[model samples]
Target: MTLRGERQADFAYQAVYRYMINLINEVSTDTRVKLPSLRQLSQRLNVSISTIQYAYSLLEKEGRVYSVAKSGYYAWPLSGSPSTLPSGDLLERLYVAARRPGMVVLSADEPALLASLDATLLRLERELVRQHPRHLQSWSQPCGVWELRAALAARYTSSPSRCWHADDVYIGADLRGVLDILIEVLGLRGSTVIVESPCDWLILRLLQDAGVRIIELPWAPDGRLDLPALEGTLIEETVQLVLLSSAVSLPSGVAMQPFERLEVARLLEQYGCWLLENDTYSELGFQPQQAALRDLVNPDRLVVFSCFEKILGPEAPYGYLLSRHMSGELQRQFLLRSFRLSSIRQRAIARLYHSGQIDQHLNTLRQLLREQAGEMSQRLDHHLGDQVTYRMPSGGATFWLGSVHAVDMRQVFQHLLARQVVVAPGELFSLGGLHSQHVRLSHTFHGQPNLEIALAALGEALRQAQLG
Candidate 1:
C-alpha cells in the first residue's frame, strides 16, 4: 500500500507468481502433483518474503495453489488420489496426531535396543580423543579418508565376487546428503525415474523435489518386484534411472530376492539405464550377501548408496556412494560443491571396523532383530489378522499393513496417534497417491511387550474406524 517501493515489490511478486504457474503446469502429472516451497521460489527468483506471500496469496485466490495449515502450498489436487496430504504436511500432521506424552512411535525405523549403541559410542569417543589433534587440523578429502574406504572395501571383499576399490567409494555427511549429491551429479531432473509404488517415503520426497518425471511400478502383494509390469514399462518407455531398495524396502520392510534382482538387472541392461541400489538397510538384514545386482551387470551401470547412520545412530553421520565408473564425475561434483566430511567420524568408523567391535555389534543386532521381528509378527497376526493384511519381510526395520476395507489410512493413522501410538500412513510412500488403506509399523521402536500393546491398540483403532 506504500508508494514506489511497494510498486517494485508488487512487480516482483507478479513475476514470481507467473513463474510458479508455469512450473506447476509443467511438472504436475494427473496423479502426482508437486510444488516448490516459498523459500525455494523466493531464493530462486531473488524476491523477498513479502513478495512471495503476495504471490502465494494471489495463487490461492485463483485456486492455483492450496496451503496446508503449517505446511507449504500445493499446486493442485491429484486426480484419482487417495489422500491430498502433501509431503510438507506429513511431519506436522504426525506431530499433531501425537496427542499424549511418551507416545509409542511404531512409525520410525529406529534401533530396538538403544543400549546396543553404548559400546559403539564409547569406542567413537575414544577414537575422537585419540584423533583430536588431527581432526582439529584439517578437513577430509572429497572422496573421504582412505582408512574408512579401505575398511569398507575389505568388508565388501569378504563376500565372494564383491570386491570394491577404495577409489570407487565417495563419502558424504549422511544418507540424505549423499542422495542429494547423487541426484544432482547424475542429472536426473526432467528424466524419467522409476521407483516402486509404496516406495520409501524419503526416496519419493527426494525424487519429487528433484523434479524427475516419476513412474511408479507397483510391487506385488507378496512384496516382490512386479517384474512383468517393470519389463513392460522398460520396453515401452525410455527410463533414465531406477531407484531400488534391494536389501530392505523402507516402511514396507520387503527384501528383493537375488533372482528378482537379476531380472531387474537384465531389464536395466536391455534398457541402458542406471540402477541406484539403496542399501541403507543392508547391514540389518538376515542373510546378508555381498553380491548385489550391480555385481551382475556392468559396474558402470549401477551405484550403491549405504550409510552407517542407521547402524551406528544419527550422531555418526556418514554414508558412501559406490559408483563403479562415475567416481571421477562424483569427485568433480564433490570438489565443485566443496563437500567435506568430519575426519573424526571417518576415524571412529574405521576404528569400529579394526577392533572387531563392528562385527560384534552387527551379530548381536541381527539376532535381536530377528527375534524381535518374530515376536512382533506373531503379535500382529494374533491381534489384527482379521482386520488387516500383512507379511513379515525376511529382514528390515518395518512391516506393511493393509486394511481389509477401503478405508483412508491417514485417518486410521491419526486415530492411532490420538490413542498414543503412531504408524506411517501408506499415502506418503506413493508418487501417484494410491494405497490409502495401508500403513507401516516399525517393530524396532519398542520392545515386545510395548509393541504388543501398540499392535493391540492398532487393532482396536481399525475396528473403531470401521464401525464409525
Candidate 2:
C-alpha cells in the first residue's frame, strides 16, 4: 500500500477501535458480552473487514476484549463501569465514603488551609457593621457589593489593552452559580463547546446538565495541548465556546506555556469563538511568572471564571466572573437570575485585599502547596515505585496516576475505601471510559499522619486489582 493509503487505513482502524470501546462501555454489564462480528462491524462502519480485525486484535492485546475459538470477539467484563454512573451519583458515593469515621481522603481536590483569617475577617466585619448600621438591612446590588467588585476589578486593571472596571465584574457564592448564569445568559444550551479531557469533573457535570454539547480535546502524550486537533475541530465544527484552564489543568495538572496560550488565542480568534478561561488554578502555579490567555485573546471574546475557595478555603465561598464585553442584555439577564451574596462577607474580603493580607496569605499558601507536592512525589516514588507512573504537577493539589500495568481503578477505589481510605477513580474525570487504569490523588492530606499509610494502602489496592 502507498504511504497515504497506510495512513488512511490506520485512521480507519483507530476510529473502529474507539467506537468499539465506547460501545462496550455503554453496553457491558457484569457479564462478558459478545461484540459485533468483524464482517458486521466492517459493514456498519463502512470499513474493510481487515481494519475491523485489526481493531479487535489490538483490543484483545490490551485485555479489553477476548476472542472465542469461532464465536468471534467478546468484550471483557466491566463489572459495572463507573463512567456509566451519573456524575451526581458518583460524587455522592465518594462524599459518603469520605465522611466515614477515620477515613483518610486523598480524593478531595480542595486545597488545605494553611492559615487562619478569623481575626482579620471578624475585625473587618465589625467595622463594616459599625460604620453603616442601616446598611445591614439593605440588600447588596444583584451584581455584587460595590466595594468588593471594585477591589477585585483593581487587580486586573494592569492590562493596558483592556480597561477593566467594577461593572465588568460579577460576584457569586461559588463557581457553580457563576457558571450557571453564564450558560443561561450566553444562550449556550445545545451549542457546541470544546473542553480539555481529564478536566474538572464538576465543570463537565455542569456543562452536561446545561444541555450543551461537549467535544473533549485530549492532551498530547507529552502533556501539552493538542493544538492540531483543536484547530481541526475549530475548522470542522461551529463551536460556540472553548472552555479550558490556561494554567494547571485539573487532574492532569499540566500547564500550557505562554507560547501555547498564544497559539490557542490565535485559533479562538480565527474561529470567532468565545473563550471561557477557567483560571481557578492559575494563581497556584509554581512558576513565578505566569502568562494569561486574556493578554493574547481579544478582550471582547474572553470571559474569565475564577474562585477564591481553592486559596481561602470553603469558608470563603466567593467566585467572580470577569468580562468587559458582555452584551447589555446578557448582563441584565445574569443580574436578574443571580442572587445577592452576603454584603458583610464581601466587604470583609475586600478589606482583606485592600490591606494586602490576601496577597500575603496567597504567598504562604503557594509555598506550602509547592512543598507538599514535592513531598508527595518523593513519597510516591518511595512507596509505589514502579507499580505506578505519574507526572509531577507543575502546580495544583492533585496528582494524576496511571498504573504501570492494566489494573481496574474502580476496583482499586473500592479496595481502598474498604481500608478506610478514599480515592478518585479515573472514570470520574472522563465520559468515554478511557483512563480506567488511572486515578487522581490529591496532596491535600500530605501533612496528616495517615498519609503514608494511605499511600501504602493504595499500593496494596493496585497490586490486588492487578492480581485479580
Candidate 3:
C-alpha cells in the first residue's frame, strides 16, 4: 500500500479508535451506542469518507467496535475496561465534562457553591495577588491544599461535628470524580452495589455501565429503605456497598430520617458493608434544622460525597468525599484520574467558600425554592389526586414524583417535549415497572413568563397520556 494510503488509514484508525474508547467512558458499557454514519462523521470531523470507513474497519478487527449487516458501526459493550480512558490532572476533565452537549443536568443534587465565587471575584483577585499571586504556577502537593481542605471541612458544617479534618478533605470535580475515587479505594469489582429505587439517573447509568450488579433498595415515603425488602435483597444479592443519601438524595430529594439512618447504619456496620452517602444536594437546604446520615453515626462503613453543581449551576466543578479511611491506592486512583478537575478551580472554590456568599445565596434560594416548590406541589396536587405521587422535601431542590400507572410517562414526555415543556421522566429513576408511573418536577413557574401556561400544556398532555 502507498505511504499516503497507509498514513490516511492510520489517522482514520486512530480517530475511530479514540472515539470508541471515549464512547465506552462517556456512554454506558452495558448498553449499545449508535455510532454516526461514515458520511455523517466525515462531514463533522472534516475527514475523508474512506478514512472513516477504514478506521471503523480497523476498530472492528481489533474488537473495539463492531458493525451489523445493514446497520451502522457501534461500540461494543465493555467489561472491566482498558486504560484507554484519558487521565488528566482533574481540572481539564472538569472543563470538558461541563461543556458536553445536552448536559441539561438536573439529576445530581449539587448545591450552588459558586455563587460566592461570583460575589468574590474582584476581591478574590486582589486576595490572590496579596496572598499568592503565583498560585497558578504552583503544583498541587500532598494531601491537597491545607486551606482548601480546611474550607471544605468548614463548608460541610455537619450537625453534630466535623467527622473529618482539613487534611482529610480532597476536592474532585463532580459525581464522576468522587465515584472514581470511591471505586478505587473500595476495590468494587465483582462486588454487589446497592442503590435506591428511583435514584439519580446518572448514578444508575454509571454503576450499570461499570457492569456492577445492583440491588434496588426500596425507597418508601419517609426516605426509608424498606428494611425487610433490603435485608432479603442483601442476603440474596450479597451487597457490598450501600449508596445512601444522607443530606440530599438526587432526583428524590428525600433525606434519610435520623432514626432510619441509625437503623440502616447499624445494619450496614453489622454486615461489614460500605455505605456511599451522596450528599451532593446538601447545600440546597435553607433550613437550619436538617440531619445527615454522616452526622448520625461514626461508623467506618460510610463515605459521603457532596458536590457543587445544582444551585451554583453545572460545571462549577467541586466534589468532596469524607471517608473513614482513605487508602493510598484510593489516593493513587484519584490522583491518576485527577485530569478531570483543576487545582486552580479548587483554589478559587476555597477562596469563594471562605467569602461566605454560598451560605447567603443558599439561604435566599432555599426560601425561594420552598415557596416555588410548594406552589408546584399544590398545582400537582390539584391536577392529580392519586394519579401522581411526590416528595415535599423539607429542603433541597429536586423531588421524587410518581404518576398514575395508566400514564405512560414516555408518551407524556414526548408530547410535552414536542410542546417545549421539559420534565424528567419517571422511568429514569426506577428499575422499570415499579417507577413507570412517575415524573420528577424540579422547575417551577416561579418567575419566567407563561409558567402556568406551559405547565397547563404539560398537564393536558398528562391527562391525554393517562386517559388514553
Best by TM-score: 2
Q: For candidate 2, list the clashing residue pairs, or say none.
A: none
Model 2 lDDT tens row, 181-213: 788877889999999888777788778878999
Give the Cα RMSD of candidate 3: 11.3
CA lDDT of each prediction against the hidden true structure: 0.70, 0.76, 0.59
TM-score of model 3 (CA atoms): 0.71
Model 2 worst lDDT window (10 residues):
1-10
For model 2 the local lDDT of residue 174 reads: 62
Per-model TM-score versus the true fold: 0.76, 0.78, 0.71
Listed per model in order, the count of residue pairs whose N, CA or C atoms clash below 3 Å is: 0, 0, 18
Please give the ranking of all candidate structures by lDDT, highest first, separated by commas: 2, 1, 3
User: What value does the lDDT take at residue 303 in candidate 2?
Assistant: 88
Q: Could you tell me how far off, in angstroms, the CA of residue 225 lies in candidate 1 after the best superposition?
A: 1.7
Q: Say which prediction, candidate 1 or candidate 2, comes out ahead on TM-score.
A: 2
Please provide, for model 1 over 208-247, each residue's C-alpha lDDT reduced to its tens digit, 9 standing for 90 to 100.
8889899998777887888998888888888988888756
Tens-digit lDDT track for model 3 on 9-87? 2134455557656664676565456688877876666554544555564454344665543356666545412222124
- Candidate 1 segments whose C-alpha is farther than 4 A from its true place: 1-88, 95-101, 112-115, 158-162, 288-290, 336-340, 445-453
Candidate maximizing lDDT: 2
